[model samples]
Structures are given as structure tokens and as C-alpha cells.
Target: MARALPLFGLVLLASGGLMGCGERTAARAALSPPDRAEYMGIETQLLDASTVSFIVRMRGARDRSDVVAYARCAAAQYTVIRGYSFAQHVRTNVRRSGEIWEGDGGFVISPDLPAGRRNLDAEVIVDDCREQGIPTV
Candidate 1:
């Protein structure tokens, strides 16, 4: 009976460990290295002068984040090309069909860094994009 009790406790512990590690599993997944995303192309539209729209597409994304990153890279390069130092993200819509991912992002380009958590420094983001092997438009 003593040996049987220990075995039962071991079984309970093993089962509990499996069911209680959901958050740990999610954290591990979040920390996993990014997959290689293939840059397809970027289309730029002038919503106005300071406001610009970027349509970016790619493949091999792990999720919608890759598409959003592609759009961010495009927006950064576009801001720099327009002689702006910063861009504030307005909105981004991401969609995935099959293996392809598409992101439509709108930004307000400014000579100075905009006041927002979502504001992006054009030069810094462009550099990051380059380092990450992400193309910009």
C-alpha cells in the first residue's frame, strides 16, 4: 500500500505538471527566434503630404506580426525618403491568405519624433530593418 501511494502521487504530479505549463509554453514560444520571412513587395500611397499609406506583402511568416513588421519597415524607409525623422503609426491591418501575408499601415510622418508609444524613429527603424534583413521601400 505504501509503494502504491507513492506511485499514485508520482502520477498526479506528472499530470499536474503537464496541465500547468501553458503559460511557460507560451513564453517559450514568444521567445523563440523569428522565422525567415520572404519580402515580396511594398506599395506606397500618399494619403496626404504628411500622412502616408504603406501596403506590404510577404511570405513565410510565422504569424501576422511578420506582415506588420514588413509594413513598419516600409513606413520607416518612406519617412526617411520624405525627409522625415519620425513616424507615428495610425493603423495597421494584417491579413493572411494561404501562405502569403499582407499588411496595410498608415503613418503620420513628422520632422520631429511624435509623442506616442507607437511613434517610430525613421532612421532607427530603417537600421533595424536592415539588420534583420527586412527590406524597405
Candidate 2:
């Protein structure tokens, strides 16, 4: 019984160490972008003078909704950066591979909000994202 106790204690210690390692990994991933193997970032393409497309990529445990939100935030910021006041969402495509999620959102930016599309004000969208604690670029 004495020998068994020491062996059991050693096993517990090893398991605790392994569990802590996983916690540290999860905490680090939550705090910052994932490593290159599982990188998260955004890319933008200019489709025309008024239209643009944004792609947001995320890896590991992130939801599809989060990916779409990030893309929307990017579109809003991009509209402001391009000297536009409003953006209209045209379309979006989402895909997932293994642990990575990618969302592509297309927007048409205009100085004035258009008549019949799903329009968003650049400043208002960005502000809403900020209030919601969502990151933008």
C-alpha cells in the first residue's frame, strides 16, 4: 500500500503538469493571434472604385459568427479609410478547413447611403463593434 501511494502521487503530479500546459496554451491563444501554423488575419481586395472585398481568417475554436463579425468590422473600417461614409453589404462567403475558419465579405461604399441595400454607416458600425468588444482593422 505504501509503494502504491507514491506511484499514484507521481501519476497525479504528471497529469497536473500536463493539464496546466493545456491551460497555458488555451490562455495564450485567447490573448493573441495564433501562430503561423494557425494564423488569424485579414486581407482586402479592391473590386472597383466603390466595391471592396474583405477576407478574415481565424484558427482553432473560433466560431463562424466571430469570423463574419470580424469581416464586417474590417469592411466598416475600410470604408472609412477610403473616405466613404456608408457601406452596403453585397455578399459574403464562409468556409472552414480543419481548425481554420475564413469569411469573405463584399461591400459597396458610397459617400451617401444607397436606397435599397443593406447599408451601414462606417462610423456607427465601428462604434458598435467597439462597444461590443470586437476587434477591428
TM-score of 1: 0.74
lDDT of 1 at 93: 93
Residues 66-102, model 2: lDDT tens digits:
5666677788888888888888877778899987888
For model 1, the stretches where C-alpha displacement exceeds 4 angstroms are: 1-34
The reply for model 2, stretches above 4 Å from the true place, is 1-39, 60-63
Model 1, poorest ten-residue lDDT window? 2-11
Tell how far residue 20 is off in model 1, in angstroms.
23
Report model 2's TM-score to 2 decimal places.
0.66
lDDT of each: 0.73, 0.66
Please give the clash total of every predicted structure, in order. Answer: 0, 0
* Residue 29 miss distance in model 2 (angstroms): 22
